[model samples]
Target: MITFESVTKRYPGGTVAVDALDLEVPDGRTMVLVGPSGCGKTTSLRMINRLIEPSEGRILLDGRDISQTEASELRRGIGYVIQQTGLFPHRTIVDNIATVPLLKGWPKAKARDRARELMDLVGLDPAMARRYPYQLSGGQQQRVGVARALAADPPVLLMDEPFSAVDPIVRATLQDELIRLQAELRKTVVLVTHDVEEAIKVGDQVAVFYPNGKIAQIDTPQRLLGDPADDYVENFLGFDRGIRRLAFFPADGLDLQAGIVLGDGTTVEQARRAAKQAGESWVLLTDAGRLPRGWAALSDLESRDGREMLAQMPLAPYGHTFRVGKDSLRAALDATVLSRTGLAVGVDDQGRVVGVTSYERLRAAIQAAEEAADGQGARPS
Candidate 1:
């Protein structure tokens, strides 16, 4: 929805904040600008709303030149969020959030009602509407800032290091909130950050800027992590890019072993014999409906006499597990790491024992992805 066509920004002292740049932010998708300080990431963002006019080339918003649009009118339709939140200290949270709607000439009551709805939408307590910004926590204030920016339901949003001022945990929470909000609202968002990790986490497309306001590369997070454009891009991705690549690799492809299953009412001797025949130390105990109850070890069954029930023997507690359909390899890895056997037990959506994935399988999947990436890199572009 926003396009920068050979845009450049220069100061009176001959300092070029932004070099001749051509970039596009597709409709309803987030594009992140990431680099170190003085790279003009923030300058590029402000130019979209005409907060900083470009010196050399024109910027287009929805096919029309922003230079022709009035500044106030243009800003009203474009949401702007900064690091400090910039809320009025004297105004209540609701009043602050309603600022944009009020500026757009909505009735006072209607604007405040809209503000309350936004507050709830951003996961804030509606009762806190009457409270001042100072009365709320730092995270709460950031939420209010987000509510304020989104109050008028603008088609485009500009966020300049909005999460940088907060602590790490709160920043993570805000990042997750932004992702959730983007999935629902799909606003054309351009977020500026020096943190490459944050950009990867939140951006649909990331623009890696160089020292002179030049773009190193602009691509999806998966592509950026899997294949950087140059050494500069690779250096920015850090040494852990391989681990980050796991975020994109699906868990469905991993080989899962068929689990040993036993009937709920089966005798201990019967269950033990079945487990031995299957070359498994433990057997998954299931009810008539095929729902997994727990795991029973063969040793537990051997100690139990016929007088004692199979359920009486100690059952190995099930650790972290995931549904077979989920795309998360991280959860599966977590399960393997926490389990004594270094294997993740995969259960169906109905809670039935489907199979188990060992650490070896997980390692092989990662190796395959890395090899695929290397092969792609070897080819000419």
Candidate 2:
């Protein structure tokens, strides 16, 4: 929904913040601008809303040139978020969030209602509406900033290092929140950051900028990591790009073994026999509903006294286990890593144990994804 056509930004001192750049962010997708300091990633974002007018060429929103539109009107249609949140210290959270809506001539009641809705949408407590910015944590303030930007539900959002100032844990939470919000709202989003990992995690398409404000490459996160455009791009992605590719691997491609199963009421001897018959070291314990509860080792069952109960033995909790659908390879690999035997106990959404995927199978799945990506690249453009 946003397009930069040969756009360039230059200061009075002849410092070009953005070189002649041509970029497009498709409707309902995120395009991340990432690079080291002074790459002009942030400058490029500011130009979209005319926070900084371009020195050359034009920026188009949908089909019309934003340069020709009134600055206030243009900004109202595009949400802008910055790193520091920039909330008004004296205003309440609701009042801060309602700024744009209120400025646009919305009624006080309606604007505040919208503000409350946005706060809830961004995962903040509605009760915080009356609280001032100083009363909230940094993370809470950021969420309020996000709510303010999204108050009018703009189709386009410009986030300039919005999560950079927060702590790592809060940054991760915000990242997850952004991902979730994108899935639901599908706003045309342009996010700027120097962190390549963050770019990969949040970007549908990543634009790697160079020192002179030039774009090195713009491609999908998977393609950018799997096949970098140049040595600089490769280095920026780090030497561990191959390992990072594992996150994209699906679990369906892995071969799963038939799980050794036991009902909750099954006797210890019965469970032990089942484990031996299946030639497995552990048996999956399930309730009468056939939902997975935990796992029990064969040795533990053998050493148990006659009166001891299966539920009484030390059993690993359920949440620690991972479950993947029949088609997801990544989830299966994650489960394998968490499993004691390097084998993922595959369970359906209903929590019934379907099978188990071994580490060997996960390795094969990784190879398959790599080969597929390579094969696609080799095809004619």
| All candidates: TM-score | 0.86, 0.85
Residue-level lDDT tens digits of model 1 in 88-180: 999999999999999999999999999999999999999999999999998999999999999999999999999999999999999999999
Q: Which stretches of candidate 2 lie over 4 Å from their true place?
A: 259-320, 326-331, 371-381
RMSD of each: 3.4, 3.6
Q: lDDT at 372 for candidate 1?
A: 69
| Model 2 RMSD in angstroms | 3.6
Compare the candidates by TM-score and give the number of the best one: 1
* Candidate 1 TM-score, C-alpha based: 0.86
lDDT of 2: 0.85
Backbone steric clashes in candidate 2, count: 8
- Per-residue lDDT tens digits for candidate 2, residues 1-381, read 898999999999999989999999999999999999999999999999988999999999999999889999999988989999999998999999999999899999999999999998999998899999999998998999889999998999999999999999999999999999999999999999999999999999999998899999999888888878889999999998877776676565666666476667777777777778877777777778877788788888899874566766777654344455543565566666777755567777776776666677677778888898787764222
